[model samples]
Target: MNESESHGHIPAPLGSVEPHAPLLSVPSDGQLLYKISSVENLLRSIVGNYLHFNRVDSYADFPGADPHDGRQLPKDQQGNSLARFEKSPDFSAANYYDQSRARTYACCFSLENSDFIWKNYANGSEKGKVGVVFEFGRLRTMLNQTLQPGNAALKYNGNQCDQIFSVNYGIVEYVDWDTHQANVDHLQNPIRYTYLKDKERFSEEKELRISLSAMGIGQFALKDGSMMQFPSSLQLAFDFKAAIADGAIQQILYASDSDSDFLQAELHKLRIVSSKG
Candidate 1:
């Protein structure tokens, strides 16, 4: 086993930064994180040895999802909006460039095994839904390796683009965006915003998020002589076989014995064990 595996905690990698310094702590190896989804989705992940991450923008379509997910601007101490520069065309273009280059793709897990997750996320259907538990340490290590610099790449306009990759994982913080004040400098780090959610989501979700970002370096000249960059791919598929080999998956929870039996047979085909919830 490697040092990280033995230690049960993940160290932030090259491009990962803690903008919310004191509040976020890496979860321990034994910490159980739950992901509730359809049985088909859960089986697909296990059979494919990968997890799919959707662009931050895609999440805006979810019910009760924060509208300002990735576009939230920092507020000054006096509660003033510090986005006055957004009105300028030049600044707007630049902002769009930055936002596109640093676009975040994320997958969510919950720190709790609440009925709310089963009801909303798993559709509350015993035959079609299930929850999977993962060990944080192994999951983090797998993500760090899968997102390492050259393991993934971005393309724009049919051309390969130079990019810097980063991966971050942490417990999400529920905050009232209107009342929260962030350092102006926080805007420079896109992953930081993924950790913050509306306070209304706190009680039931208790979310843990894994976010991946790529900052594009290659640029194209706009008609106005300004430079802009964008990514063509808005999603990422990361392999988790290594984590599974490390016993990252703890258990598969099913609502009924019949469901458990079906899962066991399916999992047995993949050499994975299944248990009743």
Candidate 2:
């Protein structure tokens, strides 16, 4: 067939097809907003279609690990990575996201019954609020991340007893702070430190450290040397305060004594607990 006849149905290319590519390119400045909108629409549609979240009941196991290159850490004689710290399997997505970079990462499982929803609001001025719907993918990605040990974990001495110490530990969870009241009740008992098996667990000599993290916002290493991540549960005393701060979150304050600091007092308390531990 003649080129014109065979390709007749094909419209003539417009000045090198690449020239039209710009139309498909998303503007960097607007990309975030677009993503937010898309996520919101997807969430509404999913929620509207599904009467309940029963679809998310299944757990997706982690896929096989990729082969480690020469850059991978060396294993000890026992085949353990000396640098690796042992962790629990009900692995939290918050922990993983806390350690991982802000960039994209792999999910531990597919979100079958779960649906993710994100809400973005323009706060006064240039700042804005982002509300996120928790889902399996987000949860798993977060679990794979880690918290900066020095910041999130606090060790301090208590005023009541010289030997009394306090520790504040934080974990990630899909549930919000309000939902954690029940969980905290369960954790009131002494936590045995297997790592310090020789040390006895102390009950009276302590206060728990306060933990703070935004629900929708992912973790970030702050400029003042603090790391931020989602909290398993937030303290009740700071409920209103936390809601306000998280709503206006742009940058996380890492190490300031200002009332704006996320968990300064909590950290101090945690240290006290740790010393005892």
Candidate 3:
């Protein structure tokens, strides 16, 4: 089936807006998103027909990434207040803000197919790099269908815990945190932070983020001698072979002519074809 036939019908893209509008907005279904990575990673994803999300905290090595990317506490619990809580006798700040327990796994993509993205993400590797193009609507459809509702048992501080799984995708918002304030309620909805980035990254990366979040309902003690139920983290992967069959993937841009030949052969071996072809 064709693109429109696959997604039912395409919607108009959400145009540019002021900072901190709704955190999630859908682009035009026909819009192409690019994922640049090492050829090995691309090949693995293609051959396995799966997308893998690394724990959000493990992105410390990414350029211009915040050191505390996935570890931010709620607004009321930040800065000087956090210092005071750290010294509190009744409050165990570590347990209360146990980022490890509330895990977020993410895979990133770019709306722009620029040289900057190519150099930063796909360059400087002996193995070379490649960019995979995905159609927005089909990808969204695949992710929605692939989303599985399940429960997980977790252990934190020797206590048994349970978490529920959820998935989200959207355009990443670039913010000048020095000036722009995020209107999100981090205490109740921390997963929204996954779609935020510093303005320094705005020019280079127009990002689209897909995140899988697993949060538990365990209660933790606050510095005020009160308890609040918070989310614990989990990680997961999803198979997209069916979406591929429906033409979610648009094209593969290889680093070289030789790489193109290699990909054509590899894709042929996997029995994959672009909808355009």
Candidate 4:
């Protein structure tokens, strides 16, 4: 909810409220809108589709592998330095052009489920409505190839370049603030981010910050200060059914501010009434 939406609803006075008060919900509001839930859902889908099995070995994970040597040593069949580190999963295809496979890092941004950053942004409490907070300790760097074109779709063939983690959905699903509805358009600039060679610059300092600009298109700056614009398209299909069927879903949550004890209380009340009869 935006500040406008938040301000529209004020909590009722204590005297006017009841423990089991029935609340009304907007079952069908036609106005096009977007919420933090959309982000959560999309992220969950990304994790299921790719993040869960990102097997690219980190230098730190390799015994005695110098962190500074991460840039070299790993080479593909051609002996050319690998563009990126990825696990060669037989089931997952690497480059769409070659029909080959390799390890691809599944980079993601995590905000603990309980974090109330969304609430602050919604209520206009965040100054820029732009800066974000990322836990560096939980950070993961992605393939440099992806940074070139965040949009993985092949320009001429309509093929998603990397089947393993390439996003298949189009821009039609993104929320367009101008129309205040969902809009679809090809990405002129694919949303992309790149981590600096010195990953420890921020972690050594023990600080993480996310930057956002929300007026027109929301842009999020990665911890490495790489800018990944909020996609003008929605690649994660909003179809929860398909997502679940394909195992592209991690968790589902339906949350509300209503009393958590309402259901149990109602059942108990019914039992008492029946006993009297």
Reference-based TM-score of each model: 0.70, 0.14, 0.67, 0.21
Any runs in candidate 2 off by more than 4 Å, and if so which?
1-123, 134-137, 147-277
On the 0 to 100 scale, the lDDT of residue 276 in model 4 is 27
Judge candidate 4 at residue 194 and give its lDDT.
12
> Model 4 segments beyond 4 Å from truth?
1-35, 38-111, 121-239, 258-277
Compose the digit string of candidate 4's lDDT tens values, residues 11-92: 2111111111121111121211112233233334434432222212233442332242112112121222122223322211
lDDT of 1 by residue, 13-129 (tens): 234433233545556767899988777777777676667676666655446665565545445322223332433423332353246435667688998888878777755345577
**Global lDDT scores for all candidate models:** 0.59, 0.20, 0.57, 0.24
User: Which tens-of-lDDT digit does each residue in 1-277 have in candidate 2?
Assistant: 0122222232211111111122121122111111112222222333332111100111122132122110111211112212122343232322332222111111111111112211111112122222222322222222222222222222122111111112112111121222222222221111111001111221111111111212112223333444433222211111222222333111121111123222334434333111221
Q: Best-fitting candidate, measured by TM-score? A: 1
Off by over 4 Å in 3: 1-23, 62-66, 71-102, 150-163, 183-188, 216-241, 273-277
Once all C-alphas are superposed, what RMSD does model 4 give against the true structure? 24.0
Cα miss at 81, model 4 (Å)? 26
Q: Give RMSD to native, each candidate.
A: 9.3, 25.8, 12.1, 24.0
Instruction: Judge candidate 3 against the unseen true structure and give its global Cα lDDT, from 0 to 1.
Output: 0.57
lDDT tens digits, residues 91-169, model 3?
3333333442255667788998988777777555556788878898888776665453333333344564333335677
